[model samples]
Target chain A: MKSAQRTTRRPLALAVAALVGLPLALSACGTSTAASSSEAVTEISVMDYYNNEPDKSFIGDALTKCGTQAGVTIKRETVPGKSLISKVLQQSSSKTLPDVLMLDNPDLQQIAATGALAPLSDFKISTDNFAEGVLSAGTYKDKVYGLAPTVNTIALFYNKDILDKAGVTPPTTWDELKAAAAKLTAGEQYGLAFNANPTYEGTWQFLPVMWSNGGDEKKIDTKETEQALQLWTDLVKSGSVSSSALNWTQADVKDQFMAGKAAMMVNGPWQIPALDKQPTLQYGVVKIPVREAGQTSVAPLGGEVWTVPQTGNKARQAKAAEVIACLNSDENQMSMAKVRNTIPSKTTLAEKFAAENPKLATFTELIKTARARTGELGADWPAQATKIYTAIQTALTGNASPADALKQAQGQ
Target chain B: MSLTTDLSQTAAPSSGKASRKHGRPAGPPTEAQAPRRRTRQRRERIFQWLFLVPAVVYMALFFGYPVVKNVVMSFQDYTTATFFTGEAPWVGLANYVTVLSSSLFSTSLLNTALFTIGSILGQFVIGLALAIFFQRKFPLNGILRSLLLLPWLLPLIVSSAVWRWILDKDSGALNRFLGDLGVINTGVPWLTSTSLALIAVVGVNIWIGIPFNLTILYGGLQEIPDELYEAGSLDGATGWKAFRHITWPMLRPVVSVVLVLGVVYTLKVLDIILGLTNGGPANSTQTIATQSYDLSFHEFKFGEGAALGNVLVIISLVFAVLYLRASRRAVDE
Candidate 1:
């Protein structure tokens, strides 16, 4: 009996040792790794490029819905959009990538070239179902590599109550915009929220107003760019807008708007939820005012695409694409639209949303003329954008003129 | 006979002749001394090999291999397409020439030098003052010393974050408090202005550096003999004169050590920059450390980034060599 007891204890001791040492040895292999587990499971990694925590839970819910529909248990992973491209590059070199990927509009090129993403052209749904510009965005060269999951457009958000009180119509031209902005300029309230600082809040901002008037950085000497810049600088010079808040963010503009301090703000429909929560202010959104008489009311598009890494098996890639399709189905799109506060991508479902949701219908109408910035070709674009915005910032601060600023950007 | 036998066994005729150039007597025949010496020699050899293995292995896998690979990569024209999947196109010395001639690279070098000089000098002066202050017997010296250490002890991310809040123009507590005291009429754009952003970040870095410098220098000052000061005073010296002749000479070795460390630490600075403006406000504050990150992570130009990194390593190495030479000279004198 004593001999038997000794025999049993040796194996148990060795098993305990193995348990203690295994995980440490494994973690040392890499910073992160996929550990295949028994029991039915599918792993999917999504990019929450903005690192928005609320959206993480939204992805979790959407995947759960899709998993139920597909009869598979899906595991989810998320990476911030900024460094996610680098991480993908590191993994792609070794031919290992997550089963599913979420491609931000900017990162589509990097991953498509990495040879790690499987093409989504073979998926069950026809690619034509999505909006033209967004569908084009998810395609790299001639190949469609991702699905247009969510579509959005830019517009001018105005406080309805303030507009009525001031007895001013929403501006449709440069002159009218300046005049209306002057009329609304009273007390602490700004005539229009035009503080473009850093990159995202600024880059395409004053540029769009200029572009509408036939201005462009490429066409440096155009009157449109100068006129648009003048409109903004004039607002600052007139004291209708404060240069002190020149480096402010969209959040800052939203803050001033919510308090009924700013009558007009150029923003996308993504901000509708925050604006809707204001108890005192009544608001309406419209096509962004144009610089030229016949020019379309132009706004920038903000959207996302679902991509599959090439490392994933083709069948699995097809299944993931199908799952993405199911998630963007009419009911699911409506579910997300309720939370996203933006227009859905699908034409048929979009009609359903417009029929039922009044605000969404108004947003869809504006989408007819909205545009996306030049599709990013170089990875340097993000950095280039920040630099260009700073140039504009320099011009705004009286350190440089619009011509000087544009010249500096051209040199870079 | 035993000594001669051991010497005969171990030393080649050339080594024995080589040993004579330093002017040591060449007779060998001490039997009792031979084994104890041999055992000690054996122990030292084993220890030398043991100590060398970890360092060699680390250098081979991480440092040596990466550098060799990087130099090879510098000859290639790498884009996203050619970087990971296909054979890279060789570009010879074109990358090196491009980097050397580029205005951005030159600007980055200037920024790095300015940062290094400012950080080192500021930390050294402040640290010395704190060391002297702490040396004096004062009430709550222990508590005050602990409080001084807070800046160095706090995680860099947290420290930069706190500084960001304090330096904020409109809503910062600093501007509000200073204005209340009539220091200024309005808040300064401490971060947004390109001219001021570099200074602001350097100030924060200097603040973080103070406690570390104080701690080490104070410990060093305590090791200095009290009698040396008395001896100097008896010879009729006081104040700055006394400090210059007696204190500074005594503190030279320690000061040299601190400056060497300061220079090396400043060269690798990245976390503080990342947490602040990410080397922005028009790249005015972009240092060698930040440019490395931008080139490698942001642009995927790893070869150029590695070369830039090697430049920093070389700068630190030169400073270290100078410090070592100074220490040896102090010892000999």
Candidate 2:
């Protein structure tokens, strides 16, 4: 009986070992070797979060072209946008960071603060000719750590057919926007749609409204910010904008506009491809309205900046920096901006881009005056972003007045 | 007897050869046999423990290590910079204080309790009714029972995505169906309203959990002897009376098992709520699990996130201990 039980138990123990040991053994096999000065570098790895179509292929082709120019093969990895930062931190601790890394503009300062990226000046890369906001977004502590080839910002998108039927041109100021939105409201259709969900996207959408009104992220509980919050509250309260906007994402707002449920939407130029697909939908772009007629509209900048991560491989890092510079060349930037519907980071290229692509002219104009979200707060931007979105949600849900909501969030 | 002889031989091959050469008899024990027998038993005990080594090591590597690491992380000032600099100063309960004292903590804790209790109650009552109905004689009962398992089989993320469209305010199927019936004029903000989001999330969880509860309860129902029901009928205990007296008493063990497992599973439900409302419209559906994820991933406050995660684990541990006690008592009865 003992011998028989031993035979049966031996297999069970072996099965358990195989089940647990296989993953451990496979994970242990991932040891990587960085190129030493003694050996010539041959391949460089790149990582980004453009895991979706069109942009994925577009970025892939650019990387391939640049890799050829830099005399190295590129091994690129794409992850979901939401998981990119965590993945970077994981790779950083493991000493397996990719050679070239792409980060969203606002996230640059946080990662750079970790000392995981090499400054572009280390390679003597020229940073001149880039727009002020573009350059500021890539700089951490007066050192440029990354550079974006193209940049974009949010603008107002209106359905031409619906607006024409309503006999209303696009509004240029806050009061006019409110009046137009109210007049355009009708059965089963909201006049305007934008995101106010309790997330960073909500904060991004609210930035233009706040900043254009001279509200500062540093001091959010002020009359300037409260007036901006009041405008958002008024839109939802007057039945012109849907209260569901508190839960809608930018993508959802775009869907509402395309379906004719919303006559106007606050969106970005990246949504142009989807809007262009509907031939029946004649949409026109304009700058987001300012508080008063003469005030300059200040939208938040949006784009990804490419950097060379500190991988302890000087040879490979140099090659990676060259690839980044190639990606940001004037010729590559212009062609990329045209294909991706973004404005070039360099002001000179942006003028040619706007003239060539009339559809993105408003976005190009908005990018010139756009403010980087992290320009003032640096790595501390996320905490302020959370407070802003919380205030927006509270005011929109009728839980508190705009002034009290800001006060409550600020007090926390 | 031969088994003992075989064990002794394997334990001491040199002594076995000497005895075999001398052609010693097996059964009658001399003075030397006592010591040899003791050594053989010791060897057997060692062999038995050797079989458990693999399982113990596996548990330590996978389960024990992570739990210890999480507890350690909760007390340190780990952040994005810690990944590179490897410098996490000992903050000592600061994370716990911040996480527990924050305004959202009370809301999330209450939401977690409401979500768990609401999901389990709805799932159990409806599931028990369906199981008892299916227990009766009916045609196509086997196929119908298998068909009910569809909701339990699909991935939670996929189900939540489909349900999001169905619960949408303006264009959802539920609103359209209700409008046709003149139930209401405007669409109900099922997932958007602060007052209703938690209920909507609980309702979805209950839908997903029903199949699991039904399958387990049905098996428990099958284990019960039919003679009890027959005897109860002769005693004039039929239908509801029969269930109350016979089925209910027999099914207690299964009920406790199902309820404990359901509570543990429902406490960590993050994907469904995240996919639907994302703790939005004023954070009406933010459970502890989702809040922990938001802290770690969204806010990048790893230390506070770990503290919140440990709090959840403590809650689950309490339920686990209760389950073990209940199961032990059930065995005794």
Candidate 3:
């Protein structure tokens, strides 16, 4: 009887082991061997978040070209935009960080502060002719850790057909903006649409209005910020902007404009390629409207920056820095700017590119005054950005008055 | 001093007392048998442990490490810097204090409770109704029952995205349907409204959860013997009366399992809410899970995020213990 019971239990035990062991075996299989320094560095690993098509292929080609020039093969890994930072943190903890890394500009300071990125000054890379805002975005604690090949900023993108049919010009000031939006409001289409969701994108979109109105991220409770908040509040309350703007991303706002559900939207030049695809859609770009006519539009600087992560391999690091510098070279910058529809990071290159591509001229001009989101606050900007978007959502949803919302969020 | 006597001395107490009542004589081992028996027993114990090794290792690596790390991190000043430098200063409940004291914490707690309760209640009730309906013999019954699994089978993110479009204020199918029926002239801001966002999210969750509940409850329904129903009918217990007397009381065990599991799963739902509203429209749909995610990923406050996560785990643990006790009671009954 004991032997019979043992026979039955043996199969069950084996089944249980197999069930539990399969995933363990699979997970163990995943740890790839990294290149040892003893061997000559033949390949350098690069990680970035341009997983989407067009940008993915575009950046991939550039990386390959630059990698060839630096005498190393590029092994690139692309992740979704949202997951990049977490992946980096995981890689950092494991000491498996890639030789080359890409970070969204505002995130560079935070990552650099963590001591995960090497200063470009170590490789003696030149920073001449680079846009001041772009340079500032890449700087943390008096050291530049990253550099961008191209940069972009949000602007007022108007559906020209709707504006033409309505005989309304694109608004240059907040008053005209409100008037044009209210007048264009009819049927299913809203007069204007912009994102005010509780995310950093919302904060970025709101900055053009806030900064142009002389509002400061350092002190968001100022009267200038409140006025900007009030402008957003008034637009939503008047039914000119949809209540749905509270949940819309910039992509959704662009979709609304493209489908003629919105007469205009606040977006960036990255959307130009998608817009240019639609032959029937007549659109025009302008600097985001200022609170008053005399105010200069101050949009937030938006772009990705490439950096050499501290992988503890000097030769690989040097090669990675070479690739980064090559990416920002004038030829690569101009070509990438044309194809990607972003302004070159270098002022001279950007000016020449804008003169050639009139459609991006408005964005190029805005990039001149564009403030880096992390310029003043450094790594603390994320906390402030959360507050800004929270205030925007609260005000837009009518949960509180703009002034009250700003005060409450500032205190939080 | 001989091998037989030594073997008998070691194995007698452990094996004899239990076997004595079964009429098996406690005999002394012979010299040749003693060595072989001892080796076999040792081998059996080794084999048993060998079977457990894989499971133990798997649990230690996957579940145990992450949970212990999360608990420890909650008491430290863990941040992006800690990931690089491997230095997380011990803060001793400072993270818990800050997370608990925040205004959003209260909102998230309340939302979590509402979301879990609302989703479970709707899922259980509707799921039971569908289970009972499917129990009846009908044409296309099998096909219809399988089709009901579609919502659960689809990826949560995909379902949420589709629901977002279907619930859009201006051009949503729901609004169009309502408009055509003359029930409402204007489209309802189902997901975008502060008042309705949580409810809409709960509605979507209920849709996703129904298939699991239905499949389990339907299996419970199938377990009831035909004689019980026949006897109940003869005793003038029919339909709802039969259901209350025979079906529910018999399905009690399965129901408890369904409800407890539903509460636990719904408590930690992140993807659907993130995909649909992202705890937005003025922080209306914000739950503990989403708030924890935002704390870590968006704000880079890993300590606070871990603290919030531990709080959620504690909530789930309470439910888990209750489930254990409830199951014990059911077994006794």
Best by DockQ: 2
- Per-candidate local distance difference test: 0.69, 0.89, 0.90
Residue-level lDDT tens digits of model 1 in B1-333: 243345334644445554466576776734544565566556654564576566555555555555556666677776565534655778877777766665668878988898888988899999999898899998999999999999988999999878866876655677889989999886676765677778988888999899878988898899889998888889988878778998788888888888888888988899897666566555667788887776666666666666677677678889889888977876886
- Candidate 1 C-alpha lDDT tens digits along A159-210: 8888998898888877787788888988667788755664445775665576
- Give one digit per residue, the lDDT tens place, for model 3 in B1-333: 243344445654555454556665667744655565567557765675686678766765677557767887899999899988878999998999999999999999999999999999999999999999999999999999999999988999899999998998888899999999999998899988899999999999999999999999999999989899999999999999999999999999989989998898999999999999989988999999999999999999999999999999999999999789878887897
**Poorest 10 consecutive residues by lDDT, candidate 2 chain A:** A26-35
What TM-score fits each model? 0.80, 0.92, 0.91
Residues A1-412 of candidate 3: C-alpha lDDT, one tens digit per residue: 4455555577557655654555556434544445448566779999999998899999999999999998999999999998899999989877899999999999999999999999999999999999899999999998999999999999999998999999999999999999999999999999999988888988998998999999999889999999999999999899999888887888888899989999999998888878888889999988888887899888899999999998888888989999999999999999898888999989887668888999999888888878899999999999999999999999888899999999999999
Best by TM-score: 2
The lDDT of model 3 is: 0.90
- Which residue segments of model 1 deviate by more than 4 Å? A1-52, A153-207, A210-288, A292-294, A351-366, A374-387, B1-51, B82-86, B300-313, B323-333
Candidate 1 pairs with clashing backbones:
A49-A81, A116-A310, A117-A309, A117-A310, A118-A310
Write the number of the candidate with greater TM-score, choosing between 1 and 2: 2
- Write the candidate numbers in order of decreasing TM-score: 2, 3, 1
Lowest summed lDDT over 10 consecutive residues: which window, candidate 3 chain A?
A: A27-36
Tell me the tens digit of each residue's lDDT in model 2 across A301-373.
9999999998988989999999999999999999898888888998877678888899999988888888999
